[model samples]
Target: MDSHTKSKDSAVCHEICQSHKNKVIKFFCTNHEFLGCKDCIALNHRKCQIDHIEDKCAGIGDSEEYKTTLIELEQKIKAVDAVIKKATLQDKEVDSTYDHVIKEIVKFRKEINDRLDQLQKQILADAEKKKPEDKETVKKVLERCTDLSSDIKNFKSKLQENKTSQQDGQLYIMIKQAKSKLNMDDLKNAEECLEQTDTLCTFERNKELENILTTHNAFGMLKPFATPMTPGKKSVSVKLTDKGEINIKTQSDRNGCQITDCAELSSTKLLLADYNNCKLKVVDTQIKAVVEEKALNSAPWCIAVLPEDKIAVTVPDKKKILVMAIAGKFSIIRRIPVKGDCRGITYRQDHLYVLCLGSKCVLTVDTHGKVKNIISLKNEIFVNPYYVLLSEDARYFYISNQGSESVVVVTLQGDISAVYKHKDLSAPLGMMMLDDGSLLVCCYCNNTIHHTSGDLNEGQTILDSGLQNPWAIYYNHQDQEVYIGGYCNQLKIRKVASTV
Candidate 1:
């Protein structure tokens, strides 16, 4: 027998090795089957029963054979790496899809706004034109009636002098006949004149306006929503109402992100921060339109607008705040590098207070980007401060901290007065003071808008649902509409229930 041959009666070597081999071992057969170890082929060896070792071996060895195995493994690793890279590219594709959807929705809104604006001007012109026609009709009738009255008075005076002459009688009969003809014409023109009466006037007829209000479906706009518009299998429809429990006029997909900030300029105009998309979208309320949108170079964490139409946005990633005009033009007015993550920003008079997402300090800056004051509240409870709003008098600022789940009322002099807390308060992103001194808080997690009286008590829910992630809430005094912004399956603008 060869030196490598094993006897048939030899006992199996089952002894544990001194050390486990560092290099992996593999085996293959003539049938093209492969396995990791000699142990896997023990049955095949038993069936062969020849006990031939080197002669029957397929030439698998520990030198170039092992090296070849390693090369195969490296190729497999490369294939797996390619797969991982493809997955990463897929994530970017998802992001781009969301971005495109958001842009399309915004574009739709702009078209609606433009159409509504043109329609509003047209309505005004129509009223102006109809006004003259109606006025002329009224003037003609009034003049004819006046003449009839004067003629009757003269006929009565003539009759009093003596027996009425044939000519006087004829004239009296003719005047009476003329009056009858005028009455007949007035009867024929009643409906047209009434229709013209309304068109000639500029008064807003709630019912008439409601009838003429364009009918729109929010389904298409909400197609890109991050969440199911309807929570369950039940069909959901958002409709416009004159004065109902909920008035849902506009909706747009947030493109799968939640809203972070919202500000209402009028009943027909709003400013929104599409946080995930790094975009600032402007919407029209009256026509449910998007007027303009600007893409931020970095993430737009917060936005504030001045009375002069200038806008300021803070980007945490960029570590700087940008100032831009409403025209979407950036101006190098002020560049603020915050010490921590800048979360919230608001303008009061000539000063700006920035809320830090990482610190408890409120940064105050002037119009020239000069650091004017830093208000530090000694409260250790607040870990992350989000949104800040100033009182109408500019004497106090309200800061909502997500970490503490509390809203802190602070003075311009760095004085703390009150702390409002609710069991449900999670991340209060947006806070607004209503005209009647009520406060509207955007509870992000709950997807609801909470309303509270001046003292922060008697909390009532104005809107409870239909929002994916409401980040901001703004009230437009001109149109009496509330604007909500943040992630909602997509970016969206909705008209709040308002009396005006």
Candidate 2:
């Protein structure tokens, strides 16, 4: 073909060479995303790999990799479109839910108003009943005073007339009779009647209702929620296999330190609570080293990561939860005082769930440290409830009770759903629920990690050989890795193998 005809028939690249417009785009920089002529490539992209457009396009359309990439992109687009559709429907449901809640609130308000009206009416009726008797008492006292005043006036007139016209004996007899009729004690008693009826009845508020309004400061709480983005099930079966372990030792530790809790902060960084060292350490998994450590006032038992680089650590001995801001180091932003010894803690949405070791219950509190509710398993007494974990759906929580030697599944409202116990599983400590409705629990006394279904029934031992006393276990969904910490000095990470 002629040169001009060949150039016309060739795929005319949209990316024009600014420096050489006459030299149509001939080469592409593989290093940087740009199409240029030979001169442009030599000038601006000298270090970049330059390839001719014809050679770069050779067999690309027919290649399996290219075709697969195209198919994957198309599938992703469809998935995103499906998500958009689901989200739109969820938005409509949100509106419906809002309307329903508003109606329910209105109904509740009306009920409260009616009850208050009834209380007011009852109080008014009681006050009304006292009014008639109070009026009668006042009327009788006034009548007695009027009659006594008339008798006194008559007696005084007779004495005055007798003094002028009668003998002294007659006057003296009249004076004695007048004195007998006028009793001073009766007059004094009548004057006291006004004080008795002054405040016969008054309205007083119900102390219990007053306390509820003042203490809680809210009539009702509305917790709004949105649908979460569900992840696709793994194509492989998730199996626990040991990757490696690192012994955690802080500067204060002459020997090794007890790692109580471990949480994945990032893809390659995990936060560890060194109980013996009384410090919180962030470890770099890739480097197998502690990047930063912060000294705490009390020994850290458990930790929950909050939003915006904040972490809540439970100090059982102190009976408080300290919220620390984690940037380069830890700074105590707030301290929440708890009545009982705080143990395992987790943050979900804007609230924190803390397992109270002393009370043997789980308490839910808001971000501002306000107690929302206390959850205790019904008909089951927990002796030493150590760790508590909310399910992925948040409909239930799994609590590991060391004293009871069982894992209790309780609903958010504190109703016991089921209790899981096994001869091999004793003294279950730390617990975590996986996305696929499975739980990984670490046994403190047994030094083993057990895998069970969401109901905490039908499970097998996953790890037991290398652990001394596994106190805490954390599963990283993004990295598909499990981190174990406990009474031992070493922290262990294992690969989560997925089976088909």
Candidate 3:
């Protein structure tokens, strides 16, 4: 239904007014939006003065409540008006750009059409100019000669009876006259004319069209749509300040650099390798809870958590990988002795990929500890071979090589794909790829986390505030945060900014 009709039918109350003052008259009450008699006014509003109702109504045209409401509405309207004004200015710019592009498009189209018309007109004009030429007359003569020759041939055959010899001679004479009148040269010219009329030549339309479309940008959207002018959500941006007091400082027993592997098992617990102690210490991040200190027969270099919460440790010094249940029972699952030491390790899809430091190779081993593939990086130009990261699709692999001073991208076939070089990065250790396809690299020597886009350029120091020798980087898409570990005041949890 129409808005006016609907509003009137709804009969929502929006005003107030006195009935009347004593007088023998009737008047319309605009505030109350109803009619009242003089007696009714006295009975309902005895003390209220109602003289010249229209004037009184006009004096208090708008109520205080209404005035306040109107002021608020006016403010709202002004806000919208400002937005519209800005949008109108932007629209004018878009329209101007659109008009410029459209003019080029129209000009191009006209030029193309004009060229096509010229071709058509030229063809028609050429054909019309040749219409009254001697070609037609020569064609008629040829047809006549052929007809007379056919008659002569029939008459000659009849002459074998001897009675039709004179008729045959007359027909032969006619045929000879016709043959002398025939022009073989003109017939050849006629054949050329037929070719000119019937043969189809190349138009070069594509090339001509390309020339007509001089402005390349003219083909795109006339007026690119302005992004919707909506308010964005307010987000909290936290930066680590040197002013805030450090609440916690915790350390693990490194056993004089004998063991170099540590990871946060959970939010509260930290798992560390103590080589001299011949044990793996699980300490608490919050409290002094020595959760578990399991003794091992050999030194453990790296550790991984299996699906069943079992811990898998790789021992390069012992040349063996051990699997221990969470209940603290250790067993030698698969022993893949390597020529070099194992540096970094990760388990995915029932396969363990370990970075062999000295050999410059990544060893992919099955759960049974059998070496499935040895991705040789021996010949690679940059072969520090510290950490390896497989993309979510497991198609592209990124390797952080300490010796090469750059990260190398390798294919699944162990071929050197692309090398990302950054000189500021000294001994790159941890590599993490964000969901937005950006790479976050933690440089150990520099103690800085470099944020780079897909091309690895335009890097910004996203977290140079408090990191001290950050050794590893891990992204948790579930929490939309990145966790940095190793040689920092504490594990730094950073929320990635929304790309949208």
Candidate 4:
């Protein structure tokens, strides 16, 4: 027998289970499609109902089911042979089709080349016809310059002769005449003649040709087709209430200071960074009192709440980030030295994202102050990235650019994705991402808080009236409240809710 036939018969006679060691598959588990010896059946298929392999294969060879399978196999083989024959014919026809398409493409290319050459010749001819006229205009201006030089020289010679002859009246008359001839207005006119106008020819695109080349139907009727999108769930409407302002009472040492940054510790507690006073104070939101106060070495510009009762603060001028442990009181854990001045800071997982002002980049560092990555923005997107807020998924980051008066969204890899700017969002300073994939932006110059989508593209005025230089914002998910802090001594709290 041939090797192929022998190999097929050997495979059919071989045992399915190698673990059985040539012990033929005597049992079959109907539910699990398992074939094994008595040992495998007891170990793994104990709970399953098994059948004898001989009983299952006894009449399969001569049964009507076997004849039906043979007929189906023959039909499939015939179908495959037909497909192979059709493919061979198609292969032969492909060469003719390719040649026909090449001929059409070459014909079209030649037509376009001839038309472009004709247009070029015509344009060159028009420019050549206008060259003499343009030259004559410049020549007249040069002649005027020569005439002005001659008149000035003649006046100088006449004045010298009068002075040599001791003719006082003539000399005076000559000087006066020269002064009148050299009037300021006339001199300015001469100077204007010296200014040259551009005479170089430039090409302007032909609108007809541009439309023929760029339109959707330029070469043929190119119809756009796309799969229709299924309707999605409707977004829930949000209801915002003006909850008025909360007067944040500071201690005697830190009284009436600008709150630059605020972070929610709990439902009724908040961490406020006293920028001007160079202090970080934890305040009780319910009673509007200071719970604890800590004095720092430098002015704290921004604060970020860390894991546990810890918090990180950015002191820009000091060029370092101070991580403090907050329990009953604030205690310094360690200071992370950075390359540039640190401004805004936020902690996620075990890493801290610090916005460096001097370098114009965001530094990602661990708790031990090891720098992992630096995300720098493109010049066009961000002139000044003041604050950085990472999305929940950590796929994108939103930055408020105070210099550009825009909020920019960038990927984690530092590529600019989108830029959001509105007339109301002037000098956007601080931002907070909401649970519903929206953002709350603090507009310092306009004294307004605007709400935007997660991408920072769509926005509208959420709070406009009772704000004064709103610099920082924080959202309390447990209490469903938003805290706004800025130049004013008071921290405003607003209740927010979502409707269907």
- Between prediction 1 and prediction 2, the one with superior TM-score is 2
lDDT (tens digit, per residue) of candidate 1 on 1-500: 75335532232233332233442323334443433235544545434323223333334455686789999999999999977865665465466456656766777778778987898899888877888987887776666667666866765665554344557776667667656655665544554555565433446656754754555754254443311111232211222122221222234433455457776554556677777767777765556656666666777877787767687888888767777767445454667687778878998656678877666678898766788788885578676778888766455677877878777777555655557788767677788876655577888888777665545544555676666667777766655456666655333434544432
Q: Which stretches of candidate 3 lie over 4 Å from their true place?
A: 1-290, 295-299, 328-335, 454-458, 487-500
Summarize candidate 2's per-residue lDDT along 151-200 as a digit string, tens digits.
88999999999999966898999999988877566688888877767645
Worst 10 residues of 4 by lDDT: 225-234
Candidates sorted by lDDT, best first? 2, 4, 1, 3
TM-score of each: 0.47, 0.53, 0.45, 0.52
What does candidate 2 score on TM? 0.53
Which prediction has the highest TM-score against the true structure?
2
What's the C-alpha lDDT at position 306 in model 1?
Answer: 76
The true-versus-predicted C-alpha distance at residue 164 of model 4, in Å, is: 99
Q: Write one digit per residue (lDDT tens) for candidate 3, span 1-500.
A: 69867655444322333443343345444445545665666566555545544334432435786688889999999999987865765566456446546666787778778987997899778766566454675566667556656755665555444444556766666556555545335555555656555333334446655765676764444553212121331223223223221212324444432334555566665565555556776655455445667767777767766666566777777666676666544455546666677867777767778888788788888767788788888775756777777755444467887777787766555655457677676778877776656677888887778765544434555567566677766555665556565553344556676532
Cα lDDT over the full model 1: 0.63
lDDT of model 3, residue 255: 42
Q: Which stretches of candidate 2 lie over 4 Å from their true place?
A: 1-238
lDDT of each: 0.63, 0.79, 0.61, 0.77
Output the lDDT of residue 453, model 3.
55
Backbone Cα, N, C clashes tallied per candidate: 18, 9, 1, 0
